[model samples]
Target: MGTKSAFNWVTLWASLLFVVILGFSRLSYGMFLPGIQRVLGGSYGQLGILGTVNFIGYLVGTLCLSPLISRFTDRKQVINRMTCLLLGLTLIGSALSDDFTQLGLWRFIIGLLSAIATVLVLSIAMDAVRPAERGVASGLIWLGGSAGILVTGLFAPFTIDPLHLQGWRYAWVTMGVFGVIAAIGFDFATRKRGVVTIPSQTESKLRDRESENVYRLLLNPKRFLFLITSYFFFGAGYIVYFTFLIPYLVSKGTPSLYTGLIWSGIGFAGLFNGWIGGKAIDRWPSGYTLALGLTLGTIGVFGITTNNLLFTVLGASLIGLVSFITPPLMTTALLRRDIPDHLYAVCLSIATAFFASGQIIGPIIGGIVVERHGLQFGVASSAIFMAIAALLAGLYGLQQRKLEVRDLPISS
Candidate 1:
């Protein structure tokens, strides 16, 4: 195949891999959790802890695996290796289950592998597309994940054996099989593409300098401190709704059919939102767009707390639409704002880690609020954090505008 055709082919398969990875590999566990717990005879506390463990692995993987990418010579090699390892981990998550302890270990490993797959796949997508289209490309790539969730939703009814409802081992195994297929497809698609090559050997002195630079900027108090703080708030709010939306609907006496419908709404909204987000990033300043997205997210969470299903679905859809819209642009914006290409992975990995950390805290905090106060309080509290993110973003926007003005004066 010609270079252009090869690139397109690679994009198609990588997106597919990401969708499968997002859906079956990472997100499906929530759907399977209740079933697993019933079979394992574990308390809710145990189940929640298992989730926390998996998230910790995710956080750690994002933090630790980034440097390895910089050290590798071939992007394709990184993608294939991570895909295979994640697939293997998925199989383990499916097949090995004597007890909760074993299951948690497997789940944690699966999460760790998935973080690697997600970042690599995203990097592949971003690099494959044109600069102007980066946001749209990234958005579409993530929507692959949304598609995966849709697949999970459609498959759950069929794969879940009601007789063996407690352990739904069959469902998990099927998911693992799907992940392997995705990995194989990903490997085949990228095998022939011409792409950017990372050099494996940085001279000893250069490696030391790069390490110092990466840590200096990553840990820079003056640079990303505010961005990190804002994202921390974004993490706390986004996770509460993303993780608990279905359960919250069920608790409110909504029918299962409606709950399913709401999930579909989220997926559908993401499809459109992804396109809009991509376009918006190219046409407008990304920080402004991101602030707007966070504002919408706040509204959505607050609506869910009102006990109105119409408002709740609308709010949930807004959250799904806006949050997914922000990531690609957010990444792109961070890159454009002066972070170098070499340190891009480092910055992103750190951002993801902070995001995961917030996610880690979100569930625990939300759970406490739900148990002690009520579901409304839990959801409402999340809105508060999103509001804070918006406020911080607005401040960032002001700072950026001032910097732009100062630079323009110099040019004049």
Candidate 2:
């Protein structure tokens, strides 16, 4: 196939993979947590541990990403990921023993594979698109994940009941069936038939330099420290909201159905927000866009603390719109710096590690705050971190201006 056809199909598949890996595997866990806990006869502490284990797995997956992608063809890597996803889902669905250890093992595997698969699909989509359009392309790709969450939020009430073991099992089964279809689609997209296939050595070399380039770019450019700092704060703050929003609402006397609806609203809003974010990055300085987006997102986080239904809904909408904004903007900014494609993966991997670190810590901190001070205080606290991110981004914008001035040739 030609480049046009190849890019279109690849983007489609990448979006679908995002839905499967991130939405179904990662986000769905929170939705299903109560059911899993009941079925396994575990406490909230175990549930907390489960979340930690998952993030730890995500961290390790990013660590192994270079080797995993380097060692396999794109087709082989995707297939392997699908296999792992199916196995993880199957184990999760079939469990009747109530063993926390068994559940943890499955959750860890799913987390690891999900991270690897997510990064792989996104990189695949990027490879298909031109460098200049990568921001919009990534935004479109991340919309798939939001779509998955939207669907789950709208339909999951019917599929998952905390009181019923069958509900949890059925949910996993449904996701597994979807995975089967996605795996089929991935294979078709990478098939050897009509299209252009870049050879293994080229891709192999790209994967090889991913790790080395991340550090090199970090030290050499110097501007990225601000970007990295903003990303770290975003990770720490946004996840606190994602992990705690529903519970906070429930604690505030909102029904589960309403909370689910609100979460779905966030996802629906993300569909357009991702587009707007992508376009903004395409036109504006990324540092400016990053600060503005974080400011908007920070307001949403504060809404969570408002304890009013309307305000919370508004907050969810704002947060949804900008939640994944940073990744695409960050990618576009890095690409503009003349960073090579191979190094791109490593750069993302390192950023992902910081993001994962925040994920690991966010829930723990949010939990403690909620337990001691109230859910409102807990949710409100996350906004402070996001605010810090906005400050860093603003600084980055100013620093870029000075750098630009410095790079201009002096008149002889």
Candidate 3:
């Protein structure tokens, strides 16, 4: 197959991997919280703890990944497939859970495996395409999460029955089955054609030099710190909206049907994120692109606080369009540009650890705020976090520009 054709084929299956790992395994949890609560009998605070535990597991997973990959460098594909398999089995375990504790344990395992699968899949997908196309390729891979969201939104309503209280279990089982299918497909598709590698001796020497000083190189850049900090805030901020939006709407007396439509609308808007966000990153500076996305996300979160149905729908749509996956997409693309290819996975793992840390804190803080003040205020907190992230990203952008100018060669 031609290079472009291979890229398309690999990226397609990789995106499907994202759909199962991120979309079904991770994001779908928030959407089913109410049903879980109904059957298990827990306060919002307790349920929120489940989210926190999951992120803690995620954090642990990201931290472990680099070391694991280092030890088993040649078996990266084996690791990926094994993680995918465990993730599916864990979801099945979740479906069979009888209590909050059991469910939380399963969720924790799911988070761990999901984190590994996500980082590996994105790394593979990004490696499949040319340098110039990395932005678009990352966007396409993340777009699978949007696809998962859309499917979950549509499927959630059918599986969650107020009378049954057991309907949500079926959703988990179905997601598990799909996850297994995705794993099988990904293994088959990528078996022959693996990640593109740089075989040049000079490039290998350069990579070796860079790898030795990777930590120093990454730390020396003020912009890298800003980028990761922004990622943390983005993680803390955007998750509140996703975790609470459906529950908040339900509390406001919105019908399940309208809520599903709103949720699906968010997913629908996300369909264009790859095109819009990919083009933005490809053209604009990464810092600027990140800032723009965070700003838009801030506005979207604020719009939800208004609680007007129209505004909420519009807010959800805007978030899905610009912010949902944009921050991480931009972050990864920028890192790929700056870091050596050999160290990309390690660097990404570090960045994702920061992101996971934020996710752990977000749900807990949001839960407290929601319990004390209200869901409106809880939602507003998300906007505040995003606004802070935008400022940091903008500062990073400015710093990057100045560095570029300082390094520019003078014409004789």
Q: Highest TM-score, which number?
A: 3
- In angstroms, give how far residue 96 of model 3 lies from its true place: 1.0
**Candidate 2: deviation at residue 63, Å?**
0.6
Error of 2 at 28 (Å): 1.5
Clashing pairs in 1: none
| Model 1: how far residue 261 lies from native, Å | 2.1
Q: What are the models' TM-scores?
A: 0.85, 0.85, 0.93
Residues 185-274 of candidate 1 have per-residue lDDT tens digits of 766666666544454454434544565566555444444555666777787776666555654555576654556667666767766766
Candidate 3 ranges with C-alpha deviation above 4 Å: 1-7, 196-212, 405-412
Off by over 4 Å in 1: 1-7, 41-45, 70-76, 88-92, 95-98, 155-168, 198-208, 218-222, 405-412
Give the lDDT of residue 234 in candidate 3. 87
How well is each residue in 1-412 modelled by candidate 2, as lDDT tens digits? Answer: 4334223766676677667776777777666665565667654445656776777777787778756655554453454446545634543453432577866776777777776766666665566666567667777777777887787687546534454555756666677677767766765774533332445776666556454445655443345667776777877787667666665665566666776788788888878866777666766655777888888888888776555789889888988888544544454444444455555555666666666777677767776776778767877888988898888777767766767622432210
Clashing pairs for predicted structure model 2, backbone only = 1-194, 1-195
The C-alpha RMSD in Å for every predicted model, in order, reads: 3.9, 4.2, 3.2
Q: What local lDDT does model 2 show for residue 243?
A: 65
Instruction: Give the alpha carbon lDDT tens digit for every residue of 250-349 in model 3.
Output: 7888777777778778877887886678778877845887898889888988787675899988888999999987887888888877765688988898
